[model samples]
Target: MDEEQITAAAYNDRSSYAKNRNKKRKSAGNRFLQNAKGFGRKHSFGRGAELEQEEYNYFLEILEALNGMTGDDTEERSTMANNVYAQIRDKEIKACSNQLSSRVLDNLLGFTDEETLQHVMTVFGENFRVVCCDKFASHVLQKTLFIAVLRCIGEMQVDEDKDASECRKKRKSDVGREMDYNLVMDFSPGHRRVCGKFVKKVAKFLLNNLEEFVWDSFGNYVIRQCVSNLAGITELKIGKGNSAEIRKLIVPDKWFKLINEFCSRLLVWPQFPEFPYNEFTSVLLQNILTSLDQTQDKFQMLQIGEKLLNDSFLLKDPEQDQSDERQKLPKVFHRDSSIRLLEVLVSVADPNFFKDQLYKRLFQGNVLLLSQTRATNFSVQKFLDCVSDKHILEHFFSELEVGLEEILQLGHTGVVASLAKACSRLACQQGKFVKLLLEALHCSDATGVKLLTPVLNLMPPEKQSSVQIHLHGSLILQAILDFNKPIKLVTAILETKNDQLAKVFTDPKGSFIVNAFIASKFVGEKSREKLIRHMEGCYMDLALSSHGSRVLELLYESAGSSQKEAIVRELSERVAQLNSKPWGVIINRKLRVEAYRQNPSQWKNSSKAIGGQRAEKIFDDIVDTGSQSKKRK
Candidate 1:
């Protein structure tokens, strides 16, 4: 036989044999849950299936209409949505699974009215277990969940009005909680009824395959969107809702119905210890923890903690004994994947519980050790950030400050950065921290503002053969600037010499010191003015460099009318020189220097103003998420 004939015969034989093997496996109890269906499901269009030419062409026409959609042209949008829905009416599964068509479907979802979206989601629910796990279909499903959440949030805010006493109390609680925590203001009787119905619809889809869903990478992001949006969404409560105000509200506690079910699966998880440690499942667990209420789900939080931290390396201190067993205990936090899970637990954990049960036992004595290692140093930093008690912080400071110099020397300035942030967060003695930081960098004895230079430089003065900047040093300086009693630090900054000031403004990282100082509410107005005066001789120099020009712009925004005039006056003086510099034209126009050249008074009178606080999920770094383009392909 010819070679081509022989090859074709062998390929056909192997394909038939493989099919027989899959059939045998299916009869033996399919372990991979292949083709698992939701109840009575019939329209099972497979994942990434090829589309028929006729359907593909019509969907493209639908896509063209969707892309053309703009404004609140409700009639046209409604017509387009109905036509598209008509195309997919009995074939939702097929429409959702086509890789090219799913992109169009996801956009059409954004344009659909609430009633249409609810119907589409109901169809999604019918085969939620199957379609949510599809590579091509999951994106469309995630987009739908995002819209549902916004609806719930808007609906909850639809109350007729809040009384004055309730308003005052609500404002006080909302203001502080808004800054730090992801709290839902009040899940009062009014809104809980509305949120419960929506949560039920969404959670029902996951319960059938909750375990598989939480661990299914794309599936997990759906849960993350649901929880994170619900947690921080009280932000929307403060907004004037869109033209049609959604007095609809969200119930934060009800989010746990799904979380609790997911956690139950964690207990009997067929995989045991390996399940929580698996990278995908680890992220799912972290997202659930972030949305937990301290009082409502405290037990659940601790239980999940116990499950994750169950191993000796996590729960026990390595130093308690001189055995090899003790040596392995600290290794738990050193792995990149493991450290984040531990940090998430620490952040959500009750302070007293964390300190007594977790912190002192394992991380306390290892402070210096954790700070020096590449991975565990982050754990040290996380601990410092969550710590609030003065005495506990003092105790931590006692250990960390002793090795603070070594930590910096080893290029572990992040540990020091966290310490500075701790000082800002706790309203503790940051002046002392500034002192310790300066002393650690060996500038303690430097004569004056010379100390500030080393910090901005992240190098001791004596060792400076050349000037190089480090970003951490800039962050540390900013944190110090945020301190309540920053006078001591402010004095050092104000004392920065003309030459030193020039160096500060020109360097990309160092120039940020001016913005932080000027923006600081603690610093008096006079300190800011003095800062502008320090830039007087350097305005031409400042406006010429990219970073320096940014400093000039910020100074202008925060500066008084007088400071604005001075900036314009100074820049115009050296306009000719600045016009020739590398970054001049862009900077000049950005700062509106043309106004100074043409008609300065009009610009002076009209001072124009132009304008992720969310903590990352712990397991994000470890996951190998594919790009959207690759997923479609």
Candidate 2:
């Protein structure tokens, strides 16, 4: 045979061996099933008969194999034996097989006595090494051996009645009875060492598989043991690092719940030690406050805040009897918790914390407590002091702005007026007041007036009469100097009938000011004609007042030639329109006589212009007819 053919045959032979090995394993499993059926019929046991028998036989075979090995080969053979034993004694398979065996035993033998079970467990544990040496041993077998050993120990203690006695003693101690000092003193270091090892192994296992363990059937017991171990670990100097490692394994959400529960348990459990409980509770409270503050969910924050406040109140209250020597006390309130709690409460209530009752309780009452408790609480006081700081003024203004917008949205004119008045009071600076007034103006005319009324009311008593005048006068001047359409402002000013303003216009100090304002309208070329028309209107309105003659004299003196011509033409037209009236006749008669006395040329010229004699005779006849008509009547 050539090399290639030889290799091919070898490959075929290996394949055939693998196939046979699988077939044999399957046949063995089938045989166990048959044994289970037979045992069910003969012993009236259904569950674990076959599995347990198979495991026991597997263990016996490994022992036989180890017994046959030579001394020189013993080391290697022993190693193999141990390996097989571990597989046979595995925890997972043992749990399943034990569950099944317990069910079967309960059905057939009516449950094994604790002594009998202890013996069985001991025998299995003692021979597990031989079972583990077998190549047939699997992961399930290893787990089973481990669990079986633990069960043996547990069962032995029960059979000896020591477990119940110890449990009762522990319970009594937990309930406040003094432990027997001599009995505790008699505890062996060996037992303590063994317990330490056991606890370490359990903690390590749980920490490594924490997620899976937490989801398993023994999750509750595992968590309880883990917490107990963690507490124990914290006490030992060597265990501190391990404890930290274990803590690191916990997720934040789970950690929060665990810590909260731990604190609660400490508060309620009679057996909880004071030092550790106090330490852990402080850490837990700090963690909760920090987490609640960091959580951006406002609703969730509010809920947590309420819980914290209630908890804090309970801690601080003197009536709870929580001040006893044995009680684990809460930490002195650091400013952080106090401030955080205050922020949350105020934010949740949506109260104006700067000016509200809630603010007083937190910033004044509780902060005072914190300061008294903590020497380094100055920073905290500063933080709390910010509660009523001037920064709130800005916030108030912003809210005021928002309130105004709301009023506009609701079309609540009355509310708008009230808010405007409120804003004027709050505005301290001239610029701010002016800006607010402008904003009110843009909102509504009535709102502007309402807002202005307060400002007008607030002017210095001596300056009260001048406030409206100054504002109106300034506005009017602005309108004229800017050459804007002044009609709106003029109409508003006139309609208000501000006596202060009227006085200003009449006073010597104010008259020229008013004239200067009117004169600015003529500064624009386009405004000249409009200015002239406006001036004429003003003069006509003044003419009706007692100041008419004074106003005319001032205008005449102030006018340029072109303005003079315009005013003269306006006055002449006024005289011509009024000539038919009694006042006009008297004025004309007076004017004619004055014209003659002042300038005979103008009088002779006026007399000759209209054929004077006929005009005079006509005037005389009209007068005589009037006299005759009066007599006839």
Candidate 3:
């Protein structure tokens, strides 16, 4: 018990202690050599690699633990156990004197085992305080930590066993519960807290020491990932004003630029699987659209506008082809995203920006995709109203005109007509749009004409006149006239009292009214009379031709006893004024031929009916010549 006796006892025990320590070191060395052989089969090694080989062995053991794989390989397993303990004891000393490099961290994160992850975290937490204090450590090490934490957060499970049972139940029994769990898992409070703390640390570190690295090198990717996670986190209702925190962290221009870059990259791949990169890009773009400040950076707004346009085009069902192997996919209107981006662009973008090719593409593309029945019509109307420039408005109208033309060409008459209706709604003072509507009506195919009927009816009476004239002159109108089905054409025309139609019929160059009258003759006396009255005020030339004779025939067929008197009186009045010498001679000859055919004996005695001496001589010559030859026979 005396100090000298205790010192002698300690010295006597020192050899045993040395023996045990040496045996443990030899066992660890042998196990490490075995692991080195395993590693050499998979990976090439460099000089003096044995000392460093212990680190790689430690990393593999940690990965196995994280993966929840524990086994009976006592020698190799004991070596890992001893190394972890040694790392904890010498926490202040650099384990490899190289810090945990990004490459090492990357390899660790790629592990699928949970135990390995936990071990890595354990080792990292032990040395992080010391390693993170160094400036170089803050660079690669902090970023690696941030990424590892994020991956862990993404993979974290609240109750894996319970969730597995629930997932089975959800597939067979309670779908709603499974859906709720799936939604909650991504944004659970515990996950958010863990992710937020890690993100905040990385953000602060970057702000404090690696500001230049962030600004110049990793700035865009880091900001993008953070904002995206923030958006998903906010949706979970985790923390107060997380969006505000994100906004504060990033410059507005840089944020939107990053969003554009992410969105552009997204289109490169056809499908967006549930990967972090995919989710991050989608969620970040959404957040940027939602939080964008139009007043701060107009160019950002324009860029967003361009991005939305590109997205809309890319998401569209590929152009229709009968030979396509893919089944028809639903059209992605993406209305909410598009409208949000458009509103910002309109408010902040220069008036000329609306005229840009991108803007034109979106407005013409998705704006035209709107069904005629929905609120999109109203949205487009409001859009047109908010825009102030005449040239831009004209450009919009011009694009619509082009779209309408395509719709008609494709035989989408209903869509073409609906578009014309939309055009008429564009600021009533927009005369150019009104003109375009009229032209559309004129040139529309049959379906277009049918679709345009409602639009024509909706037009103000004052505007209807010019539109009607345009319709009358259109080739489509001629086709309708020649269609021979008088009812469809009559129904279309009579629906609107177009004053321009009257002018067209009387123009001498347009045949709309004249053709209608001719068609009515075949339709019936009632229809014929109605058309005749419509034309009587404008088409005197049409009334005097065989067209009038046809009208007379219809009158004779359908006239009532009382109607007959009126018809005869009208015909007499018309004939009495027809004083052309050639017309008079032709009428006289027609009357004589009728009399001779009705009564041949009477005609032989009546020279006046047959046209005087010349007519008698011709008849006598033919009869005398024929009788002399036939009587001799």
Q: Each candidate: RMSD to true structure?
A: 17.7, 41.1, 36.2
Question: Per-residue lDDT of 612-632 in model 3, one digit per residue for the tens?
Answer: 677689999999999999999
TM-score of each: 0.69, 0.18, 0.26
Runs with alpha carbons beyond 4 Å of true place in candidate 2: 1-277, 292-295, 314-316, 319-359, 365-382, 385-633
Order by lDDT, highest first: 1, 3, 2
- Higher lDDT: candidate 1 or 3? 1
Give the winner by lDDT.
1
Candidate 3 minimal-lDDT segment of 10 residues: 243-252
Per-residue C-alpha lDDT of model 1 across residues 257-287, encoded as one tens digit per residue: 6667666766676564554446876666667
Off by over 4 Å in 3: 1-196, 209-211, 214-219, 233-399, 402-443, 446-633
Residue 503 in model 2: lDDT:
43
Tens digit of per-residue lDDT, candidate 2, span 1-633 = 653354355457556766676555345434554564565446434343234455544433443443333323423543553454345443422422433332222111112222332333444344433323222222223323222222223322332344333443433121111111111222344433343344344434444444443333343333443443233211111121344221111112323333344344434434322221243333333343333333323444444444544445324434335555312223223334343444334433433423554434333433323323333233233333233334443443343443333333332323323323333234322234334434533422443233333222323233344444333323323333333333433333333333433343444334443454346552444433433444663443333333333444455445544564455445444543323233333333433433444555665566566456777899999999999999999
TM-score, cand. 3 vs. native: 0.26
